[model samples]
Target: MGSKLGAAVAAVVLALPLLVGAGVAGIGSALFGGSGTSSLNCTPDGTTTGTVPGMTAEQMINAATIVAVGKQMGVPEPGWVVAIAAALQESKLRNLHYGDRDSLGLFQQRPSMGWGSPQQITTPTYAATKFFEHLTATPNWQTMSVNDAAQTVQGSGFPHAYAQHEDKARAVVAAVSGVRCQPTMAGTGDCNNIQAPNPAAMTAINYACGQRGLPYVWGGNGPLNGDAGFDCSGLTKAAYDAAGISLPRTAHTQYNAGPRVPDGSLLPGDLVFYGPPSKIRHVGLYLGNGKMLNAPTFGQPVQIDNYRYPGDDYAGATRPAEHHR
Candidate 1:
């Protein structure tokens, strides 16, 4: 699992898109609804009940493609839920043209990672078909939770993230296919149930907490750089660096630098970022208890502060893998 996840990380550099980033634009008729590549009897008379409210037309179109592809492939309804959940986590139901490394399309699958060519993956039908192919190939995917099934194919660092979108995935699938599925899938429940970080993650956070009294420097030296104090990204950079992980320099880049962690499923050593996905400016290491350790601006010393300070931008959080970058 670790080796596959490491390979996934190395292969898909910016593959982890922001969970709440600005929506991608300009999906025409081809990718939307069904492309009619294969015959499926899932033509909806109208928008089904339980469709996700506030979903963009692009999201609905991608959802339709996912369901259509699954049906044409003879994948079960549960498989539809798994596919929807994985797409939700990977590309937010958009057939994107760009992703980390060579990743492209709805699942952010990388040609370099052996999924398919850029042309094939960028097409909604092709992308969803490829995803279902890998998914059904997994043993007992029907019995697995959405997360387990998705993680088996995605190999994302945050394997538990797929479960977080189960309800919405179920809704999206139900809406598109007109098959109402219960929110809970077979494998597991909410990812927030994961209470404690593993020992390695604990070690990384503790190392950062130990540096609480260090002074804040703009681009000052981190422990990795062997400097006196830390900057925002530098603090997290130093902590994960101690854990033998390499991270990007800025807050925005660092946001997409590692595995995509859902909002409430954050672990101890996770890096939290501020601002919307389009404009991530600040960052910190979560210390639990609604507090994070960060270096705030020039002249402010490194210390523990409220995770959400008044007027804080509050973007999202990401967790680094336990292995070397």
Candidate 2:
């Protein structure tokens, strides 16, 4: 991850896109809702009945893709609800080609279930659909616990486990519902670059980037950067912290801190940088459109700049592997 960041930051002299999408033009996230903030107010369906707990990067992508595939295949809400719970329990939404004694896919489906070839069963969408199909064939699955409904389709070693993940599954379904999965630069980038981030997310990125042009001083991030201002690394840390993430002190240390974001996979508010040895040098919050907000140097107001510009140096970038606590 450090090496990758170094390579990206070293090439700060490229030309990036001049356009700004404002992201409001795309899907939008609603943050809070329900009678008492119980609703996630999802970026997709508008009202999330449950919540997706913070997960690993792998978990996030798998959950997102699977939900997207479900909706794409016209699988109904109950089917999705059941599938979500099953996957949440089975592998924490992680895609695994091998399962205990050949039980595989989201529902731990078996070849005996007429699920599909091994290849298809491993595919998130195909596997989820097959599980739902069996669920529909069972009697009274709609009213059953997510686990009970899933067990009807898959007789697993631990039948009750799925119940524990129901709320988590619902959260994923709501977040990824209807809205298509966009490829991420991380293994999750829109596989075909067909997706864009939600609008509130865009605004969040803008909020982070709009902070650029601010003076960079040692320890100057104020509430985050410290009272003195900020060093190159301090500036980056400050922006992300304001966006709801606390980070390590140095740029070099920050580089290896969390999930590695692949080139072009960066989202707004993503931490990007420049420097050697895979360490963080200068830091900025990505605002998409090939732009980001950076403090840069002394006496400069944190300002948004184009990643493709020749003057700004960039190393690599990172976003929260999952949601921040």
Q: Pick the candidate with the highest lDDT.
A: 1
Q: For model 2, how does the per-residue alpha-carbon lDDT over 125-228 read when each residue is reduced to its tens digit?
A: 45655665567678877788787997877777787877887777777766445343332221111112212233333334534444444566665655442454
Give the whole-model CA lDDT for all candidates, comma-separated: 0.65, 0.54
Q: Enumerate clash totals for all models, in the order shown.
A: 3, 39
- Give lDDT: candidate 1, residue 309: 72
User: Model 2: residues >4 Å from true position, as ranges?
Assistant: 1-66, 69-81, 84-213, 223-228, 311-313, 321-325
**lDDT, residue 244, candidate 2:** 64
- As a TM-score, model 1 comes out at 0.43
